[model samples]
Target: MLVGDGARLAEAAGDLQELGLGPMGTTQLAYLDPPYNRGGSFNGYDDNMPRHEWLAYIEERLVAARELLAETGTIWVHLDDAEAHRVRCLLDEVFGVEAFIADLTVESNPKGRQLDRFFAGSHDRLMVYARNPDKVVLDGGIAAAVNPADFPHVDSDGVNFRLLPLRNTNKRFNPMTTPTMTYPLYGDPETGAVAVDPGPGKVEILPVFGDLTPAVWRWSRDRAVERVDELVCRTVRGRSGTRIDIYQRDRHEVGRIKKLKTIWLSQEVGSTDTARAELRAAGVDGFRTPKPEALMRRIIELSTVPDDLVVDLFAGSGTTAVAARDLGRRWVVVERNPDTVRDVILPRLGLTGS
Candidate 1:
C-alpha cells in the first residue's frame, strides 16, 4: 500500500487501523528516511523548517509509528548531522533509552563535501531502536565480502588465511593488567616448534616477546593450547636479530559471518553516485539524494526476514519498496509528493492505486 499524504500520517495510521492493518503491534520493522532539516529544496517537500516545528513533526510521526511496531519490532531512522543528535534524543524519549540499539554511521559520500572551517561531511547516521529491547533478538552474525588480498597465506589444509601475532602489542597490556594471559611457552629456535614447557632444545617464552617494554598475550595459556592447531611459529629477522614469533592462523575460508560494526563505508554500501545511476537506468528522474537500493536491501536483510512487513514513511524514490519487493518482503510506503508517487514511484513499482 502507498500513502500519498505523509505530513498527516497520524490520520493515515487511523485509516490503516480501520482496515485491520498494524492495529497495535503488527509491523515487523519500520525504516524511516525522513527529510533532514537542512535549508535545501526538494522536489515537492519543504526541507527547511523551524527547528521546533521539525522536532514536533517528527515526534508525532514517531508516536504513530511506534504504535504500529510489534513487541519484537525495530525502527531505523536515517538522518544527517543536521538533526541526528536531536532525533536521537527524541527516539530515546519515545522508545525509551534502554531500547536504543545502535547508531550506525553510513559513509554515503566517499569524497566528502568541503567545508570552509570545519571537517568534511561525508556520512549519515541511522539510529535503530527496538520496541522491547529485551525481546528483540538481532541477527548480528551477518556475512560480508572480504578481499582475498588481505588473507594471502594458505594453511596446511589448503585454506586461505592470515597469520596474526599471538602476543598483544599494546604497551598498556601487561601481566598486571591481564593476569590470566601471562604464561610461558617453550619454542625451538631451530625447528620452529613450540611447547608449554622448557625442553632440551626449546627456549622458554614469556608473555612479552621482545626485550623492550613487552605486552601480554590476548588469550590465556589453556585457551591458546586448546586451538594450538591453528597456531604456528615463525622465525623473523627483526632489527635486533632473528626471533621466533608465534602466530595464529586466522582462517578466511571458514566462519565468514562477523558481528556488524558501527561504520559502513560507501564501498560496503552503495554511494550517491551509484543510486543516481540506478534511478537513471530505471528511467526515473528529478529525485535528488535518493538512497541506494543496496543500502535499503542491507537494512531489510539485517532487520527482517522473508514475508515480514516493512514500512517506509518517507518513500522518496521508492527504493525501499523496490528492495523489499525484490527481497520477498511486504512493504507499505508513503510519499507526500504526488508527482513522485504518480510518475516515478508508481511507474517504477508497476502500481496503479495508492
Candidate 2:
C-alpha cells in the first residue's frame, strides 16, 4: 500500500493497522527514519524542532507504529547522534525496557562528517524493539563481509578457503560427553586425503588436545562422509616437529554468512558517499540524508522474511520501499513533504519523474 504526498505518518499507520494485512500483526517491521532534529532544513521537511517538541513528535508516531505490529513484529528506529540517546530512553518508556532488542551501529560515513564540532562523526544507530520479546522472531542473521587475508589457502578447484580444525576444542565437549564424535579418521598426510576407514599407508588421526586428552570431532561420521570433499589434511611445523591435522575448508562463500554484529561496515551496506552517489545516479535530488537501498534491505532481511509487511514512516527517496520490493516483502512508505515526494521519492521509486 502506497500513500501519496501529504499523508501523515500517524494517520497512515493507523489506517494500515485497520487493514489487518495479517492476523498476527498488521506489519512485521516498522522502519522509522524520522527527522533527526539536527537544526537543518531540507527540501520538504524541517529538522529544527525544539527538544521537547521533537520528543513529542517521535512519541506520537512510535505509539501509532506499535499498534501496527504483530506479536512477533519488531521496530527499527533510525537515528543519529543528535538525538539517538534521547530517543533510546524514550523508546524504553514507550515500548518497555523488556521489549528492547539490540542497537546497530552503522558506519554510514567511513570518512566521518567533518562538520561535527567535537569529533568527526561516522556512524548512525538503529534501535530495535519487539512488541512482545517472548514471541519475537529473529532467527535470521546477516551476511558477513569477506576479507582476502582470512582466506589464504586455495583448493584444487582454485577456490579460496581457510582451514578450520576439525576437533572441538571446548573442554565441555569431549569423548566422555559425546562418544559418537570420538571416532578416528584415516588420512594420507602426503596426499591430503581423509577417509573414515584406514587403508594401506593411511595414518589414523584421533581428535585430542595438546595434552593428548580425548576430544570430540566437530562433525559426526555421517556428516563428514557426506561432505568429505570439504575436509583436508594440513601439515604444520610446531615446537614438537611436523604433524598432520584434519581441517575443514571454510570456503569463502560458505563462511561468509555469520551472525549479525552490532557494528555494520560491509561494502554492501553502503556509506553516505555511496548513498548520495546512488541518488545522483538515479537523477533524484533535493532530499538530504537519503539511505542507500542496501542498508534498508539488510534491515528488512534481518527483521522480517519475504511477504512480511514493512512500513517506513519517513520515506526519504523511497529507499525502504525499493529495498522491500527487491527482497519480496510488502512495504508502505509515507512522506509528508509533497515536493520531496514528487521530486525524489516518486522518481526514485519510478512512480513519477522529477
Candidate 3:
C-alpha cells in the first residue's frame, strides 16, 4: 500500500501512477471510494474542497484509472449525494458516455439521515463504467445466490428444479413486438406431454393471455426445439375448465448467476451501520464513512473473479483489499494514512500483531 497523508487526492495526486503498478491495461477492476466532497470534515480528513478542484481531483483519478483496466474490466466510483451528479458527468467525460454501465443505488444509510435541508438521503451512488463497452464482462458469481429450497421439485434424473412460465408475459413482448417468438406447440393437457410439432392425441396451444390476447414465447422456435426436453406441459384449471400451459424448468445448479439490480438493499450486502460495527469488531476506528466488506465483496464479485487484479487508490479502512484477499484475488491498494496502515489495516489483514 502506498502511504501518503495529503489533502485526500490533491496533495497525493501521483500516488497511483508512482506505484509502478502492473501493465497499463492488466487490471480487471478498480474500486474508488475517495473522500467525498461533502464540504465538511470527517475525523482528521478534510472533505471540504472547492467544487472545481474536487472535480479536477476526481477527473485525474478517473483518467488514470481508465488506463489501468483490461478490455473486459470495469470501474466503480463510490460517492454520496454531495458530488454524484457532477461526478457522473465527469465520468461520462473521462470514460466516454457509451462506456457508462450502471448507476447502482447502494442503500448505505437504511435509517436515512435525520437532519437535512429538505429531505433525508438514504443511499449512495456507485457509478460504474467499462473500459471497453463490447467487452464488458460482469458476473454476479457466488454473491448472486439463490436458496435451493425455493427450487424444491426433483426431476427424474435427480435434478432440483421448479417450473416457470415459458411464455413472455410482458405486454411489450407479444406478437406485435416479436412476431418470430409467436408459434404453436402440441401438448396433451391430460397427460402433461408436449411436442414441437403435430403429434397424435395432442392439442395445439398458442402463447396468449387469459383473455386471448396474442403473446410471444420467451424462446424462439429453433431454441425451443433444440431444448425441447427442458420444457414441460402442465394442466392449469382456471374458472373455465382445464388448459395446457407451457413451462420451463428453472434448475438449481452448482453455479447460478443472478442479475444484479440497480437498487441494492440486503443484510448480506450490508449498510453504513454494519460498516461501523465491522470496524469496531476489527478493533479499528476513526473512519467516519467506511464501507462494509460485504458491499465491497458484492462489487468485486460482480466485476471480477479469482486471481484478477483489483486496484483501490483510496483504501482507507482497507475493506476492499480485505474482501479481495478473502475472495482469492490479487490486489494493489493505497492508504494515505501510515497510522491506519500500521494500526488498523495491517492488523485487519493479519500482517501485524496489533
Best by TM-score: 3
TM-scores for all candidates: the values are 0.81, 0.73, 0.91
Q: Model 1, range 1-354, lDDT digits (tens) per residue? A: 554567567564575565334566778888888889888779777889999998988887888788888888899999988899999999999999999999999998888878625978888999999999988856664666556677898767888898888899887788777777777777775766777767798776664556634568877888877876776677777765666778778888654766677998788789877899999999987776889988988888888889888888788999999999999998888777888888888888888865
lDDT-better candidate, 1 vs 3: 3
Order of models, best TM-score first:
3, 1, 2
Candidate numbers, best lDDT first, in rank order: 3, 1, 2
lDDT of each: 0.81, 0.81, 0.81
TM-score head-to-head 1 vs 2, winner: 1
Predicted candidate 3 versus true structure: per-residue lDDT over 1-354, tens digit per residue: 333343344444344455645677888998889778776776445688888877888888787788888999999999988889999999889889999989988998888887867878788899999999999888744525677777889988898999888888788888878999999998887777778999998889888765567788998999988988888887777665556789988898777766667888846689888998999999887788899888998888888889999988788888988999999998877666677778877788888632
Off by over 4 Å in 1: 1-8, 11-28, 39-44, 67-73, 98-102, 109-122, 130-142, 188-202, 209-211, 240-242, 254-263, 305-307, 337-339
Please give, for residues 1-354, the per-residue lDDT of candidate 2 as tens digits: 574443454454445534433333568898888888988887566789999988988988788778778788999999998899999998898889999999889998898879989899999998999988999987447554446688898877887989899999797999888899988898988888889888987898988765566788999999998998888886767665566689998987653565677898847689877778888899876656778878988888878989998887788778898899889998877777777777777776678643
Q: CA lDDT of 221 in candidate 2?
A: 96
Q: Score candidate 2 by lDDT.
A: 0.81
Clashing pairs in 2: 25-70
Clashing pairs in 3: none
